[model samples]
Target: MKLHCEVEVVSRHLPTLGLRNRGKGARAVVSLCQPRPPARGEQAGPHSACLLVSTMKDKRGTRYEQLKENIEQFFTKFVDEGKATVRLKEPPVDICLSKANSGSLKGFLSAMRLAHRGCDINTSLSTLTPVKTSEFEKFKTKMVITCKKEYPLGKNFPYSLEHLQTSYCGLIRVDMRMLCLKNLVKLDLSHNHIKKLPATIGDLIQLQELDLSDNHLESFSVAFCQSTLQKSLRRLDLSKNKIKALPVQFCQLQELTDLKIDDNDLIQLPFKIGQLKNLRFLSAARNKLPVLPSEFKNLSLEYLDLFGNTFEQPKALPVIKLQVPLSLLELSARTILFNRIPYAFHIIPFHLCQDLDTAKTCVCGRFCLKSFIQGTATMNLHSVAHTVVLVDNMGGTEAPITSYFCSLVCYINSSDMFK
Candidate 1:
């Protein structure tokens, strides 16, 4: 078949028009027709180029406008979430509060009268007004209010009326017994003379971690034992408290890997402690524990800090296998405490063979040296006639003898031998 061809000029402004080798800011001849000479006197190539450029510009402009609109919508959704303005303070600073979506904003602020520095919302007016934080005794700012109706403004701490004083009108005393820190993740009342945690503390369903160390807490319970966050809890620092016993329900925290109960008054651990299958690190150091539970044998625990406890059963710790990959086993038995090794290759029972197969495999391996004991049995000489047994590979492939080969021996034992 005969073909026709024609060369046409394509402008730089319409770069998408399939023009080839068009120099910067100039036009080049792009073919419009194939395999035939242009019709006589029909050299209208440049005229056709101008029409294509106008059409390409319209298409490109519409695409650019659509992309710009999508970017603007993305920012609008994020801004509505209050993501740009809400800020949370770090440690040694006030905890940031998230806006409440419940009830009236005023009712929420009235409830959180302990937040001494943050803005208080007025639900009736739908406006947030700045709060007047009162300076209490000893130069410590009252940033958090707990136990409402119990700790009233300027009641426990004598604040002067001359300087900036906290609002006492909306401020109700925090009831320590009915303590509710709902929606509160991190609470820091450390170094304070506070006495107790509210019983309603179990309501904090979203709490993932807790730090109640260095307090005068004498006893606590498992009211939050069934909380969904129980399994999600990974870290717990209850050191320096006056706790006397470990709760059995605490074993339900299967995901807890780090637990610190140092400097407590715990006497013994509940058997349920063994149920913590994921426990990797535990510190009961400086406590009054006389003996660890036999249940500790089932734990896959790797690190245990029992530095100051009286290891009552140190000699009887055989029930617990030290099979954890990297364990730092501390054995503090009364005045006989060991911080370093006395000899190399101590051959402790914890270092014994882990399983039967591994022990048998090692015994049959090439590293065999000398056996201290040897034995052989003739077993009544097997009666009237003399019997001889021949053992060989029997022309079969010789890879290695293993547990898998024992199946043939098992099969023969199940079948009749002389029938």
Candidate 2:
């Protein structure tokens, strides 16, 4: 069998002669050829079962060496995912083959071992043809399509694809074929006509950046917010959509560093927006948001823009909802939050687990459930950002944000900030 990979040849006897050797690798096709039987009435030659390495740059053609006689040792070492190294012995020189895809390397190594033992390979000769290294690379890692005509009509995407882009393709919905690309890291579907997203898009657990900007989406899926995307999504763009609101569970994507939802119809952001500790750049410009969430003060940002929003004026009196005896559900949730206990659907009810996932945190370093005192206070946008954009054409940089208090004493102690 023939395998395409990067090949390096090291001379074992060159170093002892006090000479520097070639320190570079080249693209090569390695093949295992069976012994050709002598033709009728022709004298037998020294040809035997051999392994051939044809380097693309080598001026002297293919290097053919008898596998059983010349090779003193043959072994393989794994370097990392999708990479491996194979060492071969050729008396005075050692041939090192590396940077090969794991699948091809394994097959090549197995065939080499069997050929070295003088066994007959049952494979067809057509499968042993050398393939151009450039062609191999083009099929393996990434695929980009900017026009609708370039998209594949089949159900399967290349299984090795890590980055796929289909921008300006006029797609009305996410291609179901794309859901099978589990290795995908960055998916850019921007400038499409997609009106809705498949909840299964979150099945791509390795996805880091997803761009669905300039679409016709009217709502973001809560199922997506609760999917494995929470662990991998780092950057997202939903600009120029018709989304009216984002689910509270949307804050579960704590890994986000850059977010853009500009030119949407959002009424308000997720209530637990501050849970995203890694968020640094935020732009929600031209939305219909009336006020920011109570936890907006918890964000530490490098840049923030809330321009063109009509923010409400803060009221003087705090809205009180104190419970003399906290409900059992509230008490249980508080206990779980205070102790930092981990919960999942398997360990507790799914709804209860979701409640804990979006639990409110008070300014006093405590968590609160439904029983808490609520207040609205005006806050300077500059307090949470190093660079702040004016919230309106009147040069206003202040907006009202809600605040929650766990108890009457906590509200009384922090009431001066509201005034």
Candidate 3:
């Protein structure tokens, strides 16, 4: 269930900051981590255990076979009617069947079999992709390739290994087995039926940006997660996928500057997201998140898009205190009274306050760090997700109500938040 992103145009036009994808084609043998999920049987040695795992993988691929059967059924109907047309889902997967002769049907069947790599998933991945091997090889020397727009125009461009844009090709699966484009800097494989990304993509260690938006991918593979190729990635777009949670290995990308995971089924962000200190932009709109970690304040985000989420207002604040005590934020909360701070944020107030209104109640004992207000601790407030849940789960004992402030002026004059 990948969701469309709120702000995508910014990065598309942002010039690459001089980090070129220069690499020596030192190819590494890429392999998929065998998808593991069975309990090792008792009395089996590591060797026998490996064999059993192999057998399980072979059986696990039956779903792909089922999909192929469904498609074949669609073809059966088309062939009988001699309609020279095929539709996969009642409509919309219509294939012209290319003139309906027995040879044409056989050719179409061959193409269908090649396209359906479901029997062996990786066999159809970004590598060994039989879809456009000739096209990829024809302009092997060019720096960038834009296929979707090019294919319809019937035009060809010089291929540069630096960038590849293959949008709306109606590609289901591709084999990247022969792909070793060393200088590849960015790859846009958006809006396709691709459910899996080949680990071979990691071979492009110089690749700095990757856009995998609007694909059916549930999650990235473990092999790709562990790959060193991710180290060079400064911006990654994984919008509109079925991903529910990020892999723990995601913390490896310490240099990431931009990340967009909007419109997904994410309930919560990875606990290690704070590790991406270089991040300047984050868009997680339209998710199921209940709350963001307090560690979020640590990031120096330039642009943040969090609308359409389950996020409530940020924790209420009577006065905000500067953690590093910078000269800018050290105005004693009095100097900036009625003036705006640099940043605005939101948070959920599920269990802390009896009333969720920001102006009336200090739900999180915090407030907009952006609103300019005086520093004073007179007003009352409560921790939004903390104190209440703590009291309820902590033996349901009555706990003392505590009040904290980010600004005294903001606390007393909280109505400005509505502005």
Candidate 3's TM-score: 0.40
Candidate 2's error at 133, in angstroms? 6.0
Model 2, residue 241: what's the lDDT?
A: 94
lDDT (Cα, 0-100) at 276 in candidate 3: 75
- Candidate with better TM-score, 2 vs 3: 2
Q: What is every candidate's alpha-carbon RMSD to the true fold? A: 28.4, 5.5, 23.8
Clashing pairs in 2: 294-402
Candidate 1 stretches greater than 4 Å from native: 1-101, 105-181, 193-195, 226-229, 314-419
Question: Model 2 segments beyond 4 Å from truth?
Answer: 1-144, 154-163, 176-185, 200-206, 222-232
Error of 2 at 94 (Å): 13
> Over the full model, what C-alpha lDDT does candidate 3 score relative to the true structure?
0.45
Ranking by TM-score: 2, 3, 1
- Write candidate 1's Cα lDDT for 322-406 as tens digits: 2223223311110112222232224434333111111111111111111111111111111211221211223211111111111
lDDT of 3 by residue, 85-202 (tens): 3333322233233112233344434444433333433122211111222322432433333455454234333223467777777656543621444446787777777888787667
Candidate that would win on lDDT = 2
